[model samples]
Target: ERGLLCALALSREQFVTPGHALVLRLVRLSAEATAPHVEPALLAQKPLLDRHGNAPVYVAQNLLEQLAARFEFSASDDEFQAYRKCLRPRSLDENAPRPLVGRAIELLQFKAVIEATQECQDGHVVYVRGMAGIGKTRLVSEFLEM
Candidate 1:
């Protein structure tokens, strides 16, 4: 609370100094640090509760909400909307990569090798090496989606 009071009392110019800057940061951090708010009804629902409990899930949700509320992307509504769109989750179909085009065969081979190796009793390393833009990354990504 004293930090907050000190931060409020300091002028913008005072904030430029290292000592004042530290005070301002500490106040900002204290302001942003909040406990998660979970409903009693939600807590009562066993299926709704994560095995680890609600704190972690609600903490993340509250943090994201706080961030979204605080975020300022200019006064333009379009800019704010654009920023909000980026925060939304895409549908699975939307997330799926475009027809992996020329890498289909390699993708299939990679998937096959991965599946075959899963039964191995010993640990093994699978390395994908290729020049840039040759779709080595694309192949791995496509394989992961499988």
Candidate 2:
């Protein structure tokens, strides 16, 4: 069937394996996290998507959707693309030598660092100056979501 073929193609794509695994894990984490068509039968099928020189694809939830409505932000596809383009990691393929705090990591104590230290801003770009391993960029990046 056409649907099956699409699923097959998706399963063959990169991140499908890790995503499938994450889905399995999420089955217990949150009901809303499951993909629309994620079923046990599908899980029974091949979960390990063949890695064919393709990288993982991450789809981030728009946490700022409500904020966008409150303020002025683009809800259109084009606007979303532009916002994402700005936040995407440069040279993501280049692995970091040290294991830094990945954006996906859950609630951490360093979150309070933002609260502990306060800086006045005039609603403009401000650089977070810091030393190595201080998580300055990561702090800004956490808000990026994806």
* Model number with the top TM-score: 1
Candidate 1, position 50, lDDT: 27
Where model 2 places Cα greater than 4 Å from the true spot, the runs are: 1-51, 63-88, 91-132, 135-146
Query: Could you tell me how far off, in angstroms, the CA of residue 116 lies in candidate 2 after the best superposition?
Result: 16
**What is candidate 1's TM-score against the reference?**
0.31
How do all models score by TM-score? 0.31, 0.19
Query: lDDT tens digits, residues 7-120, model 2?
Result: 334544644544242111112457567555433334334244643433222222343332222223223334223221111223434444434345434325434444445454
Q: Candidate 1: misplaced stretches above 4 Å? A: 1-96
Q: What does the lDDT read for residue 22 in candidate 2?
A: 18
lDDT of each: 0.40, 0.36
Clashes of 1: 0
